[model samples]
Target: MEITDLTPAELRVWRAFPLNEGVDLRESADDDPADGASWGPGRTVRAEVLRALLLDGPTTGGRVPGLKLTGARVTGRLDLMYGTVDPAMRLRSCHFEKPPNLYGAQVRALVLSDSVLPGLTAGTLRVGIVLRMTGCRVTGPVRLAGAQLSGALFLDGAVLGVPGARSGRPPGPEREDSGERPEPALQLNHATVGTDVWAVGLTAHGRVRMDGATVGGLVNLDDAELHDPDGLALEAETLSVGTDLRAARLRARGMVNLSGATIPRRLVLSSARLSTPAGQALRASVSTIGELWLRGTAPVQGAVNLRGAQLDLLEAAPEVWPERVRIDGLTYRRLSPHLPAERRLPLLEREETGHLPYAYEQLATAYRAAGDEVGARTVQLAKLRRHRRTLPPYARLWGYVQDVTVGYGFRPMRAAGWLLVLLLTGTLAFARERPRPLKADEAPDFNPVFYTLDLLLPIIGFGQEAAFAPRGVHQWLAYLLIVTGWILATTTAAGVTRALSRQ
Candidate 1:
């Protein structure tokens, strides 16, 4: 059909392609009635090209085969507004030279796989369709705000040049109720991909804001250089990756805010350097970085804030500490057995510090939690010694003696010293009991004093029974005096020892 015989709908479809079979532009060129209309030079020509292609069927296959527009320069903007291509399409090395409007185009399958849009620019490149660009270059800012991408959006080795001049418009009002307006089920905002989505060297020069984006698959940014001042390199909230978020060497000058993001699988940020400010480096709150493996030291100038985040460190092998440390509210099912002794000590010593007693109590609590009863007791004893001066006189003396005795249980030398004192006292008593040399001729008189001494000796040997032995009439009085002396001497000695220890 000639272009002049076509209707507006047919012309619109025809504008998306070049000249094709069974369509003649020359015949309809002379007397076109729409000439005086608001049509631009490029739009009119593009329409004619698309018309010819629509009338022609696939050269071989039953389906519409892929369209190749390599190195083709169109004078006007190409509008593929809602066009659908049944097969893969390629615009390799094409130069739009003007804004190509693809507002809501739905490329049914792959579109622009490994193509170049160098001089080609666009106000808004709508890639909301299930588009896949394995390696495509965009020379201007591309907007895929509400686009739904099924397969990977591969920007492998693709460089997006600086954005064009800003247009005049009041800034879009910020959403007050951000939560009310649900974050994109999957939003990859301001990301600059230099390599394939799975490439080893993908880089983003501009701000790569994936804020509120949900990724159903792994968002592999391995060896990607992301530079943004606000420092929101990847702002994923409730992001779910099926596998690891492998970002080895994922250098970010801005903050990698994964606040409130959820990763059911591992979040491996090993060797990833985050050079944000002190407090705003890696903010992940109430989120989960499952099995976080941070192997190499990724110097983060900012705090690795994981305020209420839960980290599963079970997979962190003992051979080496993780390259990245999660300082959030971490929960460990079990620590690595091969963890360095130096690393283990700090974790064990993180007791809540405050007053001396409270600090010691916390230490005891931590020790108990770690199944170290002996350590807990040691902490308790240390605390007691530190606060001994504050205790009452009696309590002070008791605490002192207990400290010497019970605390010495673990010290053999101190225990032996106390035992030696007891042994010496027993030996002296035994030696005094041995038959002593007394001048037999000068035998002691059978006086009251002599009888008393005899009775006292037996009582000391066999207890108070001998003291109660029958005497003339004052036997009860004598027995009382003997019993009083024995009780007084034993109690006095004990009191003196306890009192002297305190001094």
Candidate 2:
């Protein structure tokens, strides 16, 4: 473990030992081969001496390493386990043969930018400031389970998950498909981050688990490629984010489960390609988020399961959405792309017929909020019909009757139409077979049209029917007309009451 970067006093103290010790020495990068070269032999700082420098402070003859090294080659495992130390340690472009163990350790700020590690196990580690791993590559799993970070955790351009893995080309203008196999990956379960978790251009070969994690800021995974088709590529169950979880152009080969997660802001997943045909591609069940923006360049490949999720806004065209998506109880306050009900209803066009009542309620609620009463009523009625479809034959028949007569109390005009037809039938019947007046003197002023009108008003009456003398079939015909009128009047009254109540 040769510590290449060191100070004058630090070098004197370490000069007594061999160069096999991995030491922490923070200094400037003046030994650049590109700068016409300047060098002594590479320096070595041992772990024991390094700990003394950090924990015990500097000395006159002896010294503590500043723990900042640039372009240093580390030989052995840089173990910092069970040590609660506060020092800004920045290791840049360093190559480590053995993985660093920072378990149960505490740090102020740590940087491992532009480095390559075999693997990193930092479980229960506490970082006060930023824990940056920018442009680094880890061949083995980079486990950060139960870790606590007061600042941000960046993995910009980091390639993690499997050992010796490499990412392919950037996604082109064509569809970015997750059409290949995946490898194993990383876990950050129950980790608490005060700031954001930047993962831009991250290539994780295996699954990434962030279950029960809480992020104070955004978790940006833009242009990330997580490939694990046989299982979940990203599992973020019950995770909480203060800001957005932006994953624009994220390509995942397997499922991305965000079930029961809480995002105070929006979830920007535009241009994301996730495929899990065996089950769901994305699961956000019972999650709470603000806006959900799925409006991207191309349609998503697999189904999105949003069962019982609550969101403020939904930004996506219904027509372009895939048919396999499930959205039961997926509540949203507004629909984006701002189309009218007539046009917006088409977003539900690709939805399945067996959707739950809560699913229709979500749609109806959106319509109602937009002041589209007709659209709301339609959705509600459709919901009832769909419910009826799951019932037995007799119940279905009853539902059909209600639909044709009163639109299940949604279409009052249909009931009125039936009433008109009934009245006309009665009028024609009375005109053809004129009932003679019971007495000869009552025969003179008979008008059949007025007679039909008087008979149809079941709760009201005119004197015309009394003036007529009907016997045999004509009397029976009067009975039939009265019964038909009763049915129409009853159904019409019920329908009107329902419509008023809905309004």
Which number leads on TM-score?
Answer: 2
- Per-candidate Cα RMSD to the true structure, in Å, reads 14.0, 7.6
lDDT of 1 by residue, 1-503 (tens): 56676455345434433322122222233322223233333233342353235324234434344454433333445556555534444544433444454544555443453444432221123333345544455444444544555555665555443332221121132111333222111125433222224534555544554655555566777777766544555666555555567777778776777877767677777777877764466767677767665666354666565555766553333323322334434443333333333334332233222124544555455555567666655665565676776788997886676566445132224434544444344334333343222444444332333334443332343222322233333445446445544533443445446435534
- Candidate 2 per-residue lDDT, tens place, 97-165, comes to 667878778988778887777777787899998999998877776778899999999998998856335
lDDT of each: 0.47, 0.73
TM-score of 2: 0.79
**Segments in model 1 whose C-alpha atoms lie over 4 Å from true places:** 1-61, 73-76, 81-87, 98-103, 113-130, 161-199, 314-328, 334-337, 340-503
lDDT of 1: 0.47
Candidate 2 RMSD computed on C-alpha atoms after optimal superposition onto the true structure = 7.6
